[model samples]
Target: MEAAMSTPGRGLTWSLRGRGPADVPVVADPGPWPPDSGGPAATGRGVRVCVVDSGVERDHPAVGRVDGSWVVVKDPDTGETSVRPTETGDSCGHGTACAGIVRRTAPECELHSVRVLGERFSGTGDVLLAGLRWAVEQGFDLVNLSLSTTRDRFARELHELADQAYFARTVIVASAHNTPVESFPWRFASVISVGSHQEDDPGLHLYNPSPPVEFFAPGQNVPVPWLGGATIRTTGNSFATPYITGLCARLLSAHPSMTAFQLKNALYLSAANVRFRSLPSLPAGEASDESSESDEPGELHRSRESPEPPEPRLAAGADGTGN
Candidate 1:
């Protein structure tokens, strides 16, 4: 069932290349918010994570204990997409790789998979939409979208879906296009878009004071699970996305009630780049938009003291459009 596939972009660069770590201000106080990514005890035990990709292998050593699996099928004559349970495992090893990363980061989180791509990552935009819609409807704590469509025709619908999920409190962690290009879902403000850093530390994540891409994680030449119970090292914005997703899972484990807005705020506060001063009070636990429908109650600001090199910009969502 392989078809022409959307290519995963490679080499997303968001780094302050020349500056040493000491130069950048490190603020340990991530506001008065509940513990987030750096929470030492949170292992994502109660979180339910959905990996919407080419499907995940059930018993792969690197990706142990998958909770569930599904595949999106399209009827040839009707051209409609639908979900069905499957035990066949990964079609292109992409989903397994992503699941493995999530497992490594959030070992206790229940991992689920929804296959939306075929071998070589071949898939259609409609299927991507269908799989994502189902994943969102399930109300999973976090959904990882490591794949995206570059087509402008799908943008509006995808944006709507992303927003819908945002309001539903189904936090979506999407990958930025590996290259500098227009991509859906990631560009929207509703989803937490991620890019890659070359750092070997899987636990190290950075906040992009600048975005379409909001966060950066380990993605370059990352060692991940492949097909046939083997291990392979690969790199792409896709890999980086799951790392952020896992972090989101950990955050949710600790808070258990944080909304998408507060989750994102937590991320911004925990970001290694930001100089955390006493942050303004945020809504303790507002579920949805309030009196006015907008991104947030007020703008979230980051303080950058002088003499520090500018934050590096690479990875998904670095479109610079601020959309």
Candidate 2:
């Protein structure tokens, strides 16, 4: 567990320590639902999960319902909405893919789709900050940030906001960046950084293998509902983050009093560890068993390690596509 200290003019300073290399082991593909792995029905029945990304196809089969949503960006030159289903939707297909994962893991959770990135999947930090603030104001239990920027100043402010929200007990989950270089916001210690793994392709190793990845979710060529009533296979750290977010919703719904820190610890402790042949140096940790009650607050204690390093993998395909 990483703690944030105060830094002058830097908002909050996070000194990450204890995080050694990524030591979590890889497990056999658990074949969709792990046996007796209480499906979405066991968690997140009524929780509200706010996804701040490019916009979701609200009508997608996986997206059974949306509680609320809005467009946060528009083309400055054209004066047209940049979010989808109007003049906007997921042109890059990243946002839709992420939304699908969240819906898959938390079918009953109310989704609030906030379109901060435009159809082009590009937006300034101000747009993202505004979307985050709005989600906090709306009282969402979880905020999923599938996109991030390289801007340091914006990243600091976003971290501060996330810290404040976390103290308020709102869970914030971010994709461990996919870049070969570090990305902001996701690098912030206050956010639960997620990494990618291939459930079906066990041969495919995890992406951005790092200690910062608190939990791993399916990311390689996962099936997602696409625009125009189509289904496409995609892969990225962006898609992996939603699985964590959906799981957070489930945990939060089951234990309404669990703090953001506690929920994060539950995930790390619950993760099924497997040894990757490519990274033979890392040791395997024990995976959480069904007997363990992850929904309970204080089930797992925090660690003393400094926050893990920022995700080292960059988003695929587009430079600024929302996650």
**How well does each candidate superpose onto the true structure, as a TM-score?**
0.73, 0.65
The residue pairs in collision within model 1 are: 13-314, 14-314, 176-316, 212-317, 213-317
Worst 10 residues of 2 by lDDT: 314-323
| Top-scoring candidate (TM-score) | 1
lDDT of 2 by residue, 1-323 (tens): 13343334454424435554464443421112222455323347778898888777767787767667676655567644333323345555667777888887776788878878654445457777777777776678899988877767787678778887878767788887786676767777778887787587421223233565566677878888777757898888888888778777766554455677666655543444421112122236866454445435444434323222111111110111111
Tens-place lDDT per residue, model 1, 1-323, is 01112332333225667778886774432322222434334567889999999889778999999999999888877987789988879888999999999888777899999999883334458889889999999999999999889888888888888888997889999999998988878999999999998888766678887787989988999999999999999999899998888877776665566788777866664556655333445578855444333334444345554312132211111111011
Predictions: Cα RMSD each: 15.3, 13.5
- CA lDDT scores, all candidates in order: 0.77, 0.64
How well does candidate 1 match the true structure, expressed as C-alpha RMSD?
15.3
User: Model 1: what TM-score?
Assistant: 0.73
